[model samples]
Target: MTARIRSVNVGASRDGVGSRGRASAIDKQPVASVEVRDPGPKRGGLGSGVVGDDVVSRRHHGGSSQAVYAVAREELDHWGGVLERVLPDGQFGENLTTQGLDVDGAVVGERWRVGSALLEVTGPRIPCATFGAWMGERGWVRRFTERGRTGAYLAVVEPGTVSTGDVVEVLERPAHGIVVPRVFRALCGDLEAADEVLGARVLDAQHHAELERSVARRTP
Candidate 1:
């Protein structure tokens, strides 16, 4: 199967897990069409998170580097097998559930032309506590991190509407070998590997800073 969008999901306001009473937009549903644009900075910003998508936590999500998150259907299937359940599209709270795409293998600076918009791969989606809560699984964060198939987070280079069935065309790939999985591995425990991502010229500035900090902490 060719690499194409199987679903476009947008989040809505909903109650979160645990006793925090926090609102979460993790329960995204498939949408027919939605606008894609840059969500600016991480804190106190608005960007492309779908027309009706709710970004409850701006501090760590929904920024230019994370304007969109995508996961391969194949990866979802793998997780389903491990979890012993039929994983549905958007179950990971991904904006795009892609088929026949190696999202984890995509180079950090790679550009994908989906529909009328252009998006650049920035990094991997590091599994967080909220993600674990949503999955309602034990040790999900560690399991997901060790799996190293964290999918890809993308930045919008050109605003446009995208929907299911849109062909994902790779417009460019960085010369550096810093792919999404490598970055995920680096963030998980191998900080030295982050040097590879630091070499990508087209990497998002925000991600660059975070990786730089991680690298600095180990430098002594």
Candidate 2:
């Protein structure tokens, strides 16, 4: 089946939500349409799904490397089955909820054509304390990390408008085999595995630096 966007969700930063001590855009709601664009360097990073979308914490979130986060509907379904509950799109705070895509298997630097925008897979979304709070489940972060199905973070390569049901086309895939799951495990579990992904030239500099730091810390 051809991969496609199931929903486009976005939200603004507000007070009293998540573990951020403020409302997080992580609680994204589906929208009919949203403008996708690079916010430009002057704006602090790549723009998110919609014009009013918020990036509450610039310290750890947002930026070109994580401009847009995407999660697979298949994974959501799997989780729903495991939890015996309905898992909705945007429940994980992803900007794009996609269908028919192996998001975790996508290699870093793979370019996806969604609507008119071109997006490059940059890295995986690491579950955080805020995510655990959002989920309202004990050990949610540990459970998510252990599963190693973290979704992909994308960087806008060609900005354009995107909407629900837009077909996602793979325009390019980097020769490097630095898939999302591998990177997530390397970042969160095996520090030694970081080298393989760092070798991928197409990886975003920021992400590369992060992996480098991880490797350095474990090199002693």
Candidate 3:
């Protein structure tokens, strides 16, 4: 089957699993349809690109660079086997649960036409404490990082609606070959991977700053 959205998900913030009750929408629920648009900046601007998708933690996630998150259904199934639990659609807070796409291998700067929206590849979805807490697994963050499947964040290039089964077609891709896996490895302290991913000119300014600090802090 061709790459397509198996489900579109969105969620509102829920209490607990964080300090100061830092609400999270990581437990997203599948939706029949939703609108996608550029959410502009993080703080003052709208947090989520998908209408009604809450991004409560503006200090960290959401914004133009991370307007949407996609994870492959194949990857979720793999994790299900690893964790010995049935992973459901939107289990990882992904806005789109995709089928037949090598999401982590998508190069930075790649453009995809999904539904009526045009989306651009941005960066890897980094793991955080809240995510680990939600999973209820020991060393969940480290485990997720070590597994090297960070998924992919995307920015909406054109405002449009998306729904389940929308085909995800690659409209364009840069020659740099800096895919999401390499970028995620860089974020996880792989020095050589850092150099390779940073070589891609398409790395956005916001992501560039985060990558630099993460690489430096993780490097021994």
Candidate 4:
């Protein structure tokens, strides 16, 4: 089974996840579906936000999949029709919402079909201060680390347009079980956790080195 996209909503901040100022369920018809929008001279649109449709990543700006998880069609519809209560303070800012898929189990390089658009699990999006700023708390980043429920980033594998109310199904799984959440936990200030992450082999050389450095700093 796989989770399907119930709808797509984009805003500076989420008073709700849909157009009705409320979270739209998977069934209630998506208000605004998300797709990779290409920008010309102007940099800032649907796909890449500020840096345009390119691989430009800074602190909190770039093409990163917000939330990827498994849910039921009814849950999708319920959220679409009403407010979604996920965060500690209760707000919504999901790039793509779906139903029934083990997202944490997903691995890098694995591709999935979410409507016409094909999304590949590129890597994990590192949490930064911007997320904490959005939450109105300096230590809100700790919530993710403490909870160990960080989401993964998706890169468009095939050029196809995606819309609201599209079904999301997993097409592949990684050979290893080193999921995103595990990576997040391993990246914490703890050296042991960082070493665990180093053993995962999911991270690239740069990321691996970064983790190694972080771990070494804590070493005696």
lDDT of each: 0.84, 0.82, 0.89, 0.50
Question: Candidate 1, residues 32-144: lDDT per residue as tens digits?
Answer: 87898887887877844456777877777888888999999999999999999998999998999999999988998799999999999988887777888889889998899
Task: Show pairs that collide, candidate 3.
Answer: none
* TM-score computed on alpha carbons, candidate 4: 0.63
lDDT of 3 by residue, 1-220 (tens): 7999999999888898554456788889998999999999998989999999999888789999999999999999999999999999998889999999999989988999999999999988989988887888888888898888878999999999999999999989888888888888777778898877766646789778777787778767
The lDDT, on a scale of 0 to 1, for candidate 4 is 0.50
Clash count list over all predictions: 1, 1, 0, 18
Better of 1 and 3 by lDDT: 3
By lDDT, the best candidate is: 3
What is the per-residue lDDT of model 4 for residues 110-139, given as tens digits with 9 covering 90 to 100?
778876677766455554544445444446
Badly placed stretches (over 4 Å) of model 1 are: none
Off by over 4 Å in 4: 12-31, 37-57, 63-92, 137-139
Stretches of candidate 2 exceeding 4 Å from the true structure: 41-43, 46-49
Candidate 2 structure quality by residue, lDDT tens digits, 1-220: 9899999889777666778575676788899767777655425564463566788777778777778889999999988887788988999988899999999989888999998899989888988888898887778899898899989988888888888999999988877777888888778748656776766554666667777887888887
Worst 10 residues of 2 by lDDT: 41-50
Error of 4 at 192 (Å): 3.9
Candidate 2 residue-wise lDDT at 18 = 74
lDDT score, candidate 3: 0.89
